[model samples]
Target: MKEFLCTDKDFKDIAALVYNACGIVLGEHKREMVYSRLARRVREHRLKNFSEYLAYLNSNKDKEFDAFINAITTNLTSFFREPHHFEFLKHTIVPQLLNSNKVAKRVRVWSAGCSTGEEPYSLAITLADLFPSSWDVKILATDLDSNVLAKAQAGIYTAANVNGLEDKTLKKWFLKSKDGHTYKIKPKLNKNIFFKRLNLLQDWPMQGQFDLILCRNVVIYFDKETKDTLFKRYANALNNSGYLFLGHSESMGKEHSEFKNLGKTMYQKQHNARTV
Candidate 1:
Protein backbone atom coordinates (compact mmCIF):
# COMPACT_ATOMS: atom_id res chain seq x y z
CA MET A 1 0.00 0.00 0.00
CA LYS A 2 1.32 3.39 -1.01
CA GLU A 3 1.43 6.31 1.40
CA PHE A 4 -1.79 8.25 0.91
CA LEU A 5 -1.83 11.99 1.36
CA CYS A 6 -4.98 13.99 2.16
CA THR A 7 -4.62 17.47 0.71
CA ASP A 8 -6.13 20.51 2.38
CA LYS A 9 -8.96 20.55 -0.18
CA ASP A 10 -9.96 16.96 0.54
CA PHE A 11 -9.98 17.61 4.29
CA LYS A 12 -12.11 20.73 3.86
CA ASP A 13 -14.61 18.91 1.68
CA ILE A 14 -15.03 16.08 4.19
CA ALA A 15 -15.18 18.50 7.12
CA ALA A 16 -17.97 20.47 5.50
CA LEU A 17 -19.94 17.34 4.64
CA VAL A 18 -19.62 15.95 8.16
CA TYR A 19 -20.64 19.20 9.79
CA ASN A 20 -23.68 19.54 7.55
CA ALA A 21 -24.68 15.92 8.07
CA CYS A 22 -24.00 15.38 11.80
CA GLY A 23 -22.91 18.73 13.27
CA ILE A 24 -19.40 17.48 14.03
CA VAL A 25 -16.84 20.28 14.00
CA LEU A 26 -13.57 19.18 12.50
CA GLY A 27 -10.86 21.78 12.25
CA GLU A 28 -7.39 22.06 10.75
CA HIS A 29 -5.74 19.96 13.43
CA LYS A 30 -7.80 16.89 12.51
CA ARG A 31 -6.48 16.71 8.96
CA GLU A 32 -4.04 13.93 9.70
CA MET A 33 -6.59 11.98 11.69
CA VAL A 34 -9.04 12.19 8.79
CA TYR A 35 -6.34 11.13 6.37
CA SER A 36 -5.37 8.02 8.32
CA ARG A 37 -8.93 6.89 9.02
CA LEU A 38 -10.08 7.30 5.44
CA ALA A 39 -6.93 5.88 3.89
CA ARG A 40 -8.47 2.42 4.01
CA ARG A 41 -11.34 3.59 1.85
CA VAL A 42 -8.82 4.87 -0.67
CA ARG A 43 -7.08 1.52 -0.62
CA GLU A 44 -10.34 -0.44 -0.89
CA HIS A 45 -11.44 1.59 -3.88
CA ARG A 46 -7.89 1.63 -5.35
CA LEU A 47 -8.05 5.38 -5.70
CA LYS A 48 -4.87 7.18 -6.62
CA ASN A 49 -4.99 9.51 -3.62
CA PHE A 50 -7.31 11.44 -1.28
CA SER A 51 -8.42 13.71 -4.14
CA GLU A 52 -9.58 10.73 -6.19
CA TYR A 53 -11.30 9.28 -3.13
CA LEU A 54 -13.00 12.61 -2.48
CA ALA A 55 -14.11 12.69 -6.12
CA TYR A 56 -15.57 9.22 -5.80
CA LEU A 57 -17.37 10.24 -2.62
CA ASN A 58 -18.93 13.25 -4.31
CA SER A 59 -20.11 11.17 -7.26
CA ASN A 60 -21.56 8.37 -5.18
CA LYS A 61 -24.52 8.88 -2.82
CA ASP A 62 -25.05 5.40 -1.47
CA LYS A 63 -23.58 3.19 1.26
CA GLU A 64 -20.23 4.76 0.53
CA PHE A 65 -21.34 7.92 2.27
CA ASP A 66 -22.13 5.99 5.41
CA ALA A 67 -18.81 4.20 5.13
CA PHE A 68 -17.02 7.53 4.79
CA ILE A 69 -18.66 8.97 7.88
CA ASN A 70 -18.08 5.83 9.91
CA ALA A 71 -14.45 5.84 8.91
CA ILE A 72 -13.79 9.40 10.10
CA THR A 73 -16.08 9.68 13.12
CA THR A 74 -14.47 8.99 16.48
CA ASN A 75 -15.93 6.07 18.45
CA LEU A 76 -13.59 5.64 21.39
CA THR A 77 -15.53 4.07 24.26
CA SER A 78 -15.22 1.41 26.96
CA PHE A 79 -17.27 -0.38 29.57
CA PHE A 80 -17.60 1.83 32.65
CA ARG A 81 -15.41 4.47 31.06
CA GLU A 82 -16.68 7.01 33.57
CA PRO A 83 -17.38 4.97 36.68
CA HIS A 84 -18.61 7.91 38.77
CA HIS A 85 -21.69 8.32 36.60
CA PHE A 86 -22.73 4.71 37.17
CA GLU A 87 -22.08 5.10 40.91
CA PHE A 88 -24.47 8.05 40.98
CA LEU A 89 -27.02 6.04 39.03
CA LYS A 90 -26.88 3.26 41.62
CA HIS A 91 -26.61 5.26 44.87
CA THR A 92 -28.51 8.48 44.27
CA ILE A 93 -30.64 8.51 41.13
CA VAL A 94 -32.10 5.01 41.35
CA PRO A 95 -33.02 5.41 44.99
CA GLN A 96 -34.65 8.78 44.44
CA LEU A 97 -36.66 7.52 41.45
CA LEU A 98 -37.80 4.39 43.28
CA ASN A 99 -38.93 6.41 46.28
CA SER A 100 -40.98 8.82 44.23
CA ASN A 101 -44.74 8.28 44.21
CA LYS A 102 -45.33 10.87 41.46
CA VAL A 103 -43.05 9.21 38.93
CA ALA A 104 -44.18 6.19 36.89
CA LYS A 105 -42.83 2.74 37.58
CA ARG A 106 -41.60 2.27 34.02
CA VAL A 107 -38.04 3.44 33.43
CA ARG A 108 -36.56 4.29 30.05
CA VAL A 109 -32.90 5.19 29.60
CA TRP A 110 -31.31 6.51 26.41
CA SER A 111 -27.61 5.89 26.06
CA ALA A 112 -27.01 8.51 23.40
CA GLY A 113 -23.83 7.93 21.39
CA CYS A 114 -23.30 4.53 22.95
CA SER A 115 -20.37 3.00 21.12
CA THR A 116 -20.13 -0.78 20.62
CA GLY A 117 -22.67 -1.48 23.47
CA GLU A 118 -20.51 -0.78 26.51
CA GLU A 119 -22.49 2.11 28.01
CA PRO A 120 -25.90 0.49 27.57
CA TYR A 121 -24.72 -2.91 28.85
CA SER A 122 -23.25 -1.20 31.88
CA LEU A 123 -26.59 0.46 32.43
CA ALA A 124 -28.30 -2.92 32.18
CA ILE A 125 -26.01 -4.32 34.86
CA THR A 126 -26.69 -1.39 37.14
CA LEU A 127 -30.43 -1.71 36.66
CA ALA A 128 -30.31 -5.45 37.30
CA ASP A 129 -28.30 -4.94 40.45
CA LEU A 130 -30.51 -2.16 41.78
CA PHE A 131 -34.05 -2.62 40.49
CA PRO A 132 -36.40 -5.56 40.76
CA SER A 133 -36.61 -7.84 37.73
CA SER A 134 -40.34 -7.10 37.52
CA TRP A 135 -39.74 -3.43 36.95
CA ASP A 136 -40.31 -2.27 33.37
CA VAL A 137 -36.84 -1.17 32.31
CA LYS A 138 -35.55 -0.53 28.79
CA ILE A 139 -32.43 1.11 27.43
CA LEU A 140 -32.09 2.67 23.97
CA ALA A 141 -28.49 2.73 22.80
CA THR A 142 -27.88 4.89 19.72
CA ASP A 143 -24.87 5.95 17.70
CA LEU A 144 -24.42 7.78 14.41
CA ASP A 145 -21.92 5.23 13.20
CA SER A 146 -23.78 2.24 11.74
CA ASN A 147 -20.75 -0.06 12.01
CA VAL A 148 -20.56 0.51 15.73
CA LEU A 149 -24.31 0.07 16.10
CA ALA A 150 -24.11 -3.36 14.46
CA LYS A 151 -21.36 -4.36 16.90
CA ALA A 152 -23.40 -2.98 19.79
CA GLN A 153 -26.43 -4.99 18.71
CA ALA A 154 -24.33 -8.15 18.55
CA GLY A 155 -23.15 -7.66 22.19
CA ILE A 156 -19.83 -9.38 21.59
CA TYR A 157 -16.36 -8.21 22.57
CA THR A 158 -12.75 -9.24 22.84
CA ALA A 159 -10.80 -9.63 26.09
CA ALA A 160 -9.31 -6.17 25.77
CA ASN A 161 -12.79 -4.65 25.72
CA VAL A 162 -13.60 -6.24 29.09
CA ASN A 163 -10.20 -5.68 30.64
CA GLY A 164 -11.11 -3.86 33.85
CA LEU A 165 -14.45 -5.62 34.46
CA GLU A 166 -14.66 -7.56 37.70
CA ASP A 167 -14.77 -11.36 37.64
CA LYS A 168 -18.18 -11.63 39.26
CA THR A 169 -19.81 -9.16 36.88
CA LEU A 170 -18.11 -10.73 33.85
CA LYS A 171 -19.19 -14.25 34.70
CA LYS A 172 -22.74 -13.24 35.52
CA TRP A 173 -23.41 -11.20 32.36
CA PHE A 174 -21.21 -12.65 29.64
CA LEU A 175 -20.51 -16.12 28.20
CA LYS A 176 -16.90 -16.80 27.35
CA SER A 177 -16.36 -18.75 24.17
CA LYS A 178 -14.06 -21.77 23.82
CA ASP A 179 -11.33 -19.62 22.27
CA GLY A 180 -11.14 -17.66 25.56
CA HIS A 181 -10.63 -14.41 23.70
CA THR A 182 -14.25 -13.58 22.87
CA TYR A 183 -17.21 -12.93 25.18
CA LYS A 184 -20.85 -12.61 24.26
CA ILE A 185 -23.34 -10.84 26.49
CA LYS A 186 -25.99 -13.12 27.94
CA PRO A 187 -29.50 -12.81 26.57
CA LYS A 188 -30.73 -11.52 29.93
CA LEU A 189 -28.58 -8.44 29.66
CA ASN A 190 -29.03 -8.07 25.90
CA LYS A 191 -32.81 -8.24 26.16
CA ASN A 192 -33.25 -4.81 27.74
CA ILE A 193 -31.01 -2.97 25.27
CA PHE A 194 -32.15 -1.84 21.81
CA PHE A 195 -29.37 -0.60 19.57
CA LYS A 196 -30.06 1.77 16.67
CA ARG A 197 -28.29 4.16 14.34
CA LEU A 198 -29.25 7.74 15.16
CA ASN A 199 -27.78 10.98 13.96
CA LEU A 200 -28.34 13.61 16.66
CA LEU A 201 -28.65 16.42 14.13
CA GLN A 202 -31.53 14.67 12.34
CA ASP A 203 -35.07 13.90 13.44
CA TRP A 204 -35.44 11.37 16.29
CA PRO A 205 -38.14 8.79 15.53
CA MET A 206 -38.62 7.68 19.14
CA GLN A 207 -41.98 8.66 20.61
CA GLY A 208 -41.56 7.87 24.29
CA GLN A 209 -40.20 10.06 27.03
CA PHE A 210 -37.19 8.80 28.97
CA ASP A 211 -36.33 8.80 32.67
CA LEU A 212 -32.65 9.34 31.89
CA ILE A 213 -30.57 10.28 28.82
CA LEU A 214 -26.80 9.74 28.78
CA CYS A 215 -25.28 11.93 26.04
CA ARG A 216 -21.87 12.00 27.69
CA ASN A 217 -18.65 12.58 25.76
CA VAL A 218 -20.57 13.17 22.55
CA VAL A 219 -21.22 16.89 22.30
CA ILE A 220 -17.59 17.84 22.86
CA TYR A 221 -16.98 17.56 19.11
CA PHE A 222 -19.91 19.79 18.21
CA ASP A 223 -19.89 23.55 17.91
CA LYS A 224 -21.47 25.65 20.67
CA GLU A 225 -24.69 26.49 18.83
CA THR A 226 -25.16 22.91 17.75
CA LYS A 227 -24.49 21.71 21.30
CA ASP A 228 -27.07 24.11 22.70
CA THR A 229 -29.71 23.00 20.21
CA LEU A 230 -29.13 19.30 20.84
CA PHE A 231 -29.15 19.75 24.62
CA LYS A 232 -32.46 21.60 24.40
CA ARG A 233 -33.90 18.76 22.35
CA TYR A 234 -32.73 16.30 25.02
CA ALA A 235 -34.44 18.44 27.66
CA ASN A 236 -37.73 18.16 25.77
CA ALA A 237 -37.27 14.41 25.31
CA LEU A 238 -36.89 13.72 29.05
CA ASN A 239 -39.67 12.97 31.50
CA ASN A 240 -40.36 15.82 33.94
CA SER A 241 -38.33 14.17 36.71
CA GLY A 242 -35.74 12.79 34.33
CA TYR A 243 -31.98 13.23 34.47
CA LEU A 244 -29.33 14.09 31.88
CA PHE A 245 -25.68 13.15 32.12
CA LEU A 246 -22.90 14.98 30.29
CA GLY A 247 -19.26 14.23 29.75
CA HIS A 248 -16.73 15.45 32.30
CA SER A 249 -15.59 18.07 29.80
CA GLU A 250 -19.11 19.07 28.74
CA SER A 251 -21.69 21.39 30.26
CA MET A 252 -25.24 22.45 29.34
CA GLY A 253 -24.00 26.02 29.15
CA LYS A 254 -25.98 28.95 30.60
CA GLU A 255 -28.63 28.87 27.88
CA HIS A 256 -30.53 25.79 29.05
CA SER A 257 -32.58 26.57 32.18
CA GLU A 258 -34.67 23.41 32.23
CA PHE A 259 -31.78 21.43 33.73
CA LYS A 260 -30.29 22.02 37.16
CA ASN A 261 -26.81 20.74 37.88
CA LEU A 262 -26.51 18.07 40.58
CA GLY A 263 -22.72 18.11 40.41
CA LYS A 264 -20.52 15.45 38.82
CA THR A 265 -21.91 16.23 35.34
CA MET A 266 -25.38 15.01 36.32
CA TYR A 267 -28.52 17.14 35.97
CA GLN A 268 -32.17 17.00 36.97
CA LYS A 269 -35.06 18.78 35.32
CA GLN A 270 -35.94 21.91 37.27
CA HIS A 271 -39.68 21.32 36.97
CA ASN A 272 -39.36 18.03 38.85
CA ALA A 273 -37.74 19.59 41.90
CA ARG A 274 -39.84 20.46 44.94
CA THR A 275 -39.81 24.15 45.78
CA VAL A 276 -39.29 25.03 49.41
Candidate 2:
Protein backbone atom coordinates (compact mmCIF):
# COMPACT_ATOMS: atom_id res chain seq x y z
CA MET A 1 0.00 0.00 0.00
CA LYS A 2 1.24 3.47 -0.84
CA GLU A 3 0.97 6.55 1.37
CA PHE A 4 -1.98 8.62 0.15
CA LEU A 5 -1.87 12.32 0.82
CA CYS A 6 -5.16 14.17 1.44
CA THR A 7 -4.79 17.92 1.59
CA ASP A 8 -6.96 20.23 3.72
CA LYS A 9 -8.53 21.62 0.54
CA ASP A 10 -9.36 18.10 -0.67
CA PHE A 11 -11.07 17.23 2.59
CA LYS A 12 -13.16 20.38 2.64
CA ASP A 13 -14.18 19.90 -1.01
CA ILE A 14 -15.19 16.29 -0.42
CA ALA A 15 -17.09 17.26 2.73
CA ALA A 16 -18.98 19.95 0.84
CA LEU A 17 -19.77 17.51 -1.97
CA VAL A 18 -21.13 14.99 0.51
CA TYR A 19 -23.31 17.60 2.24
CA ASN A 20 -24.65 18.88 -1.08
CA ALA A 21 -25.32 15.38 -2.39
CA CYS A 22 -26.90 14.14 0.83
CA GLY A 23 -27.96 16.07 3.91
CA ILE A 24 -25.25 14.47 6.09
CA VAL A 25 -23.20 17.19 7.75
CA LEU A 26 -19.64 15.99 8.06
CA GLY A 27 -17.95 18.54 10.29
CA GLU A 28 -14.34 19.68 9.74
CA HIS A 29 -13.27 17.13 12.32
CA LYS A 30 -14.49 14.29 10.09
CA ARG A 31 -11.71 14.85 7.54
CA GLU A 32 -9.61 11.99 8.89
CA MET A 33 -12.66 9.71 9.01
CA VAL A 34 -13.53 10.62 5.42
CA TYR A 35 -9.97 9.93 4.34
CA SER A 36 -9.98 6.55 6.05
CA ARG A 37 -13.16 5.49 4.21
CA LEU A 38 -12.59 6.92 0.75
CA ALA A 39 -8.90 6.12 0.58
CA ARG A 40 -9.64 2.62 -0.65
CA ARG A 41 -11.85 4.07 -3.36
CA VAL A 42 -9.05 6.42 -4.30
CA ARG A 43 -6.70 3.45 -4.57
CA GLU A 44 -9.29 1.24 -6.29
CA HIS A 45 -9.62 3.84 -8.98
CA ARG A 46 -5.79 3.87 -9.15
CA LEU A 47 -5.72 7.51 -8.26
CA LYS A 48 -2.57 9.23 -7.00
CA ASN A 49 -4.24 10.99 -4.06
CA PHE A 50 -7.46 12.53 -2.69
CA SER A 51 -7.29 15.42 -5.15
CA GLU A 52 -7.52 13.04 -8.11
CA TYR A 53 -10.34 11.16 -6.40
CA LEU A 54 -12.38 14.32 -5.97
CA ALA A 55 -11.63 15.25 -9.55
CA TYR A 56 -12.97 11.86 -10.63
CA LEU A 57 -16.06 12.36 -8.50
CA ASN A 58 -16.67 15.76 -10.03
CA SER A 59 -16.51 14.29 -13.53
CA ASN A 60 -18.68 11.23 -12.85
CA LYS A 61 -22.46 10.97 -12.47
CA ASP A 62 -22.98 7.23 -12.25
CA LYS A 63 -22.65 4.18 -9.98
CA GLU A 64 -19.38 5.47 -8.56
CA PHE A 65 -21.26 8.29 -6.85
CA ASP A 66 -23.55 5.73 -5.28
CA ALA A 67 -20.46 3.77 -4.30
CA PHE A 68 -18.99 6.93 -2.80
CA ILE A 69 -22.10 7.53 -0.69
CA ASN A 70 -22.18 3.89 0.38
CA ALA A 71 -18.55 4.03 1.44
CA ILE A 72 -18.96 7.13 3.63
CA THR A 73 -22.34 6.43 5.25
CA THR A 74 -22.18 5.01 8.76
CA ASN A 75 -24.19 1.84 9.50
CA LEU A 76 -24.11 0.83 13.15
CA THR A 77 -27.01 -1.43 14.15
CA SER A 78 -27.89 -4.79 15.63
CA PHE A 79 -30.89 -6.93 16.49
CA PHE A 80 -32.81 -4.97 19.15
CA ARG A 81 -29.95 -2.47 19.35
CA GLU A 82 -32.38 -0.30 21.30
CA PRO A 83 -34.23 -3.05 23.16
CA HIS A 84 -36.73 -0.72 24.85
CA HIS A 85 -38.27 0.28 21.50
CA PHE A 86 -38.95 -3.36 20.64
CA GLU A 87 -40.37 -3.95 24.09
CA PHE A 88 -42.66 -0.97 23.68
CA LEU A 89 -43.70 -2.21 20.24
CA LYS A 90 -44.50 -5.72 21.41
CA HIS A 91 -46.01 -4.85 24.80
CA THR A 92 -47.99 -1.72 23.92
CA ILE A 93 -48.03 -0.50 20.34
CA VAL A 94 -48.68 -3.67 18.30
CA PRO A 95 -51.29 -5.07 20.65
CA GLN A 96 -53.34 -1.90 20.66
CA LEU A 97 -53.15 -1.53 16.89
CA LEU A 98 -54.13 -5.13 16.31
CA ASN A 99 -56.96 -5.22 18.86
CA SER A 100 -58.56 -1.92 17.97
CA ASN A 101 -61.35 -2.19 15.43
CA LYS A 102 -61.01 1.53 14.69
CA VAL A 103 -57.44 1.01 13.48
CA ALA A 104 -56.56 -1.05 10.42
CA LYS A 105 -55.80 -4.72 10.99
CA ARG A 106 -53.00 -4.47 8.47
CA VAL A 107 -49.65 -3.30 9.82
CA ARG A 108 -47.05 -1.33 7.94
CA VAL A 109 -43.60 -0.53 9.36
CA TRP A 110 -40.78 1.42 7.79
CA SER A 111 -37.29 0.80 9.12
CA ALA A 112 -35.75 3.91 7.72
CA GLY A 113 -31.94 3.74 7.68
CA CYS A 114 -32.19 0.00 8.25
CA SER A 115 -28.56 -1.06 8.09
CA THR A 116 -27.95 -4.70 7.19
CA GLY A 117 -31.52 -5.67 8.32
CA GLU A 118 -31.28 -5.95 12.12
CA GLU A 119 -33.99 -3.44 13.11
CA PRO A 120 -36.62 -4.68 10.67
CA TYR A 121 -35.76 -8.31 11.39
CA SER A 122 -36.17 -7.69 15.11
CA LEU A 123 -39.53 -6.09 14.39
CA ALA A 124 -40.48 -9.12 12.28
CA ILE A 125 -39.49 -11.49 15.04
CA THR A 126 -41.47 -9.47 17.56
CA LEU A 127 -44.56 -9.46 15.34
CA ALA A 128 -44.18 -13.15 14.58
CA ASP A 129 -43.98 -13.94 18.27
CA LEU A 130 -46.95 -11.74 19.16
CA PHE A 131 -49.31 -12.48 16.30
CA PRO A 132 -48.20 -16.02 15.25
CA SER A 133 -51.15 -16.05 12.88
CA SER A 134 -51.60 -15.10 9.25
CA TRP A 135 -51.65 -11.32 9.47
CA ASP A 136 -51.11 -8.62 6.92
CA VAL A 137 -47.68 -7.32 7.98
CA LYS A 138 -45.40 -5.39 5.66
CA ILE A 139 -42.08 -3.76 6.62
CA LEU A 140 -40.28 -1.49 4.22
CA ALA A 141 -36.60 -1.37 5.13
CA THR A 142 -34.67 1.34 3.37
CA ASP A 143 -31.16 2.79 3.46
CA LEU A 144 -29.18 5.26 1.41
CA ASP A 145 -26.27 2.82 1.17
CA SER A 146 -26.95 0.25 -1.52
CA ASN A 147 -24.17 -2.01 -0.25
CA VAL A 148 -25.82 -2.36 3.15
CA LEU A 149 -29.21 -2.77 1.49
CA ALA A 150 -27.84 -5.73 -0.43
CA LYS A 151 -26.63 -7.28 2.80
CA ALA A 152 -29.98 -6.53 4.51
CA GLN A 153 -31.94 -8.20 1.72
CA ALA A 154 -29.84 -11.36 2.03
CA GLY A 155 -31.00 -11.94 5.66
CA ILE A 156 -27.80 -13.66 6.63
CA TYR A 157 -25.58 -12.98 9.61
CA THR A 158 -22.60 -14.34 11.47
CA ALA A 159 -22.98 -16.17 14.79
CA ALA A 160 -21.94 -13.02 16.66
CA ASN A 161 -24.82 -11.06 15.18
CA VAL A 162 -27.35 -13.27 17.02
CA ASN A 163 -25.45 -12.96 20.31
CA GLY A 164 -28.02 -11.61 22.77
CA LEU A 165 -31.14 -13.28 21.32
CA GLU A 166 -33.00 -15.78 23.43
CA ASP A 167 -32.39 -19.45 22.60
CA LYS A 168 -36.02 -20.10 21.76
CA THR A 169 -36.16 -16.93 19.65
CA LEU A 170 -32.99 -17.94 17.78
CA LYS A 171 -34.23 -21.48 17.12
CA LYS A 172 -37.62 -20.19 16.04
CA TRP A 173 -36.55 -17.24 13.88
CA PHE A 174 -33.16 -18.22 12.41
CA LEU A 175 -31.79 -21.35 10.80
CA LYS A 176 -28.21 -22.26 11.48
CA SER A 177 -26.16 -22.86 8.37
CA LYS A 178 -24.82 -26.37 7.82
CA ASP A 179 -21.37 -25.22 8.95
CA GLY A 180 -22.92 -23.57 12.05
CA HIS A 181 -20.86 -20.45 11.48
CA THR A 182 -23.67 -18.37 9.97
CA TYR A 183 -27.37 -17.93 10.62
CA LYS A 184 -30.00 -17.01 8.11
CA ILE A 185 -33.38 -15.55 8.95
CA LYS A 186 -36.18 -18.05 8.39
CA PRO A 187 -38.16 -17.59 5.18
CA LYS A 188 -41.38 -16.77 7.02
CA LEU A 189 -39.62 -13.89 8.78
CA ASN A 190 -38.22 -12.62 5.50
CA LYS A 191 -41.53 -12.63 3.64
CA ASN A 192 -42.96 -9.40 4.99
CA ILE A 193 -39.74 -7.37 4.75
CA PHE A 194 -39.16 -5.42 1.54
CA PHE A 195 -35.64 -4.01 1.27
CA LYS A 196 -34.83 -1.09 -0.99
CA ARG A 197 -32.04 1.46 -1.39
CA LEU A 198 -33.66 4.74 -0.46
CA ASN A 199 -31.91 8.05 0.19
CA LEU A 200 -33.97 9.68 2.95
CA LEU A 201 -33.19 13.12 1.55
CA GLN A 202 -34.75 12.15 -1.77
CA ASP A 203 -38.43 11.62 -2.60
CA TRP A 204 -39.91 8.44 -1.14
CA PRO A 205 -41.36 6.25 -3.88
CA MET A 206 -43.67 4.22 -1.64
CA GLN A 207 -47.25 5.47 -1.49
CA GLY A 208 -48.84 3.99 1.62
CA GLN A 209 -48.34 5.42 5.12
CA PHE A 210 -46.62 3.40 7.83
CA ASP A 211 -47.99 2.42 11.23
CA LEU A 212 -44.52 2.46 12.79
CA ILE A 213 -41.43 4.28 11.54
CA LEU A 214 -38.10 3.46 13.19
CA CYS A 215 -35.58 6.09 12.11
CA ARG A 216 -33.38 5.59 15.15
CA ASN A 217 -29.89 7.00 15.44
CA VAL A 218 -30.11 8.25 11.87
CA VAL A 219 -31.01 11.94 12.05
CA ILE A 220 -28.28 12.61 14.62
CA TYR A 221 -25.97 13.12 11.64
CA PHE A 222 -28.21 15.75 10.04
CA ASP A 223 -28.22 19.46 10.86
CA LYS A 224 -31.06 21.08 12.86
CA GLU A 225 -32.92 22.38 9.80
CA THR A 226 -32.53 19.04 8.09
CA LYS A 227 -33.81 17.30 11.21
CA ASP A 228 -36.93 19.52 11.27
CA THR A 229 -37.64 18.86 7.59
CA LEU A 230 -37.10 15.11 7.97
CA PHE A 231 -39.27 14.96 11.10
CA LYS A 232 -42.09 16.74 9.27
CA ARG A 233 -41.72 14.24 6.44
CA TYR A 234 -41.85 11.44 9.01
CA ALA A 235 -45.09 12.91 10.39
CA ASN A 236 -46.53 12.94 6.87
CA ALA A 237 -45.36 9.39 6.16
CA LEU A 238 -47.04 7.94 9.25
CA ASN A 239 -50.69 6.95 9.57
CA ASN A 240 -52.95 8.50 12.18
CA SER A 241 -51.94 7.44 15.69
CA GLY A 242 -48.76 5.99 14.27
CA TYR A 243 -45.49 6.03 16.22
CA LEU A 244 -42.10 7.49 15.39
CA PHE A 245 -39.01 6.24 17.22
CA LEU A 246 -35.97 8.48 17.15
CA GLY A 247 -32.44 8.02 18.42
CA HIS A 248 -31.98 8.52 22.16
CA SER A 249 -30.06 11.75 21.54
CA GLU A 250 -32.53 13.05 18.93
CA SER A 251 -35.76 14.92 19.69
CA MET A 252 -38.69 16.61 17.91
CA GLY A 253 -37.46 20.09 18.93
CA LYS A 254 -40.42 22.01 20.45
CA GLU A 255 -43.85 20.35 20.56
CA HIS A 256 -45.54 20.06 17.20
CA SER A 257 -49.35 20.04 17.08
CA GLU A 258 -49.18 17.04 14.75
CA PHE A 259 -47.15 14.89 17.15
CA LYS A 260 -46.97 14.48 20.92
CA ASN A 261 -43.95 13.11 22.75
CA LEU A 262 -44.62 9.79 24.42
CA GLY A 263 -41.16 9.93 26.07
CA LYS A 264 -38.06 7.79 25.43
CA THR A 265 -37.73 9.31 21.95
CA MET A 266 -41.15 8.03 20.93
CA TYR A 267 -43.73 10.33 19.37
CA GLN A 268 -47.36 9.53 18.63
CA LYS A 269 -49.22 11.14 15.77
CA GLN A 270 -52.07 13.17 17.17
CA HIS A 271 -55.21 12.50 15.24
CA ASN A 272 -58.81 13.45 16.05
CA ALA A 273 -58.62 10.93 18.88
CA ARG A 274 -55.57 9.99 20.99
CA THR A 275 -55.17 6.20 21.30
CA VAL A 276 -51.90 5.63 23.26
lDDT of each: 0.88, 0.86
Task: Kindly give the stretch of ten consecutive residues in candidate 1 with the minimal lDDT sum.
Answer: 267-276
lDDT of 2 by residue, 126-241 (tens): 88766636667889999999889999999899999999889998899899999988999999889989998888888889899888999998998899888888888888888878
TM, every model:
0.94, 0.94
Look at candidate 2 and give me any clashing residue pairs: none
lDDT of 1 by residue, 26-103 (tens): 999987788788999999999889899888998895958999999978888899878999998999888877877235
Q: State residue 242's C-alpha deviation in candidate 2, in Å.
A: 0.8
TM accuracy, model 1: 0.94
Say which candidate scores most in lDDT: 1
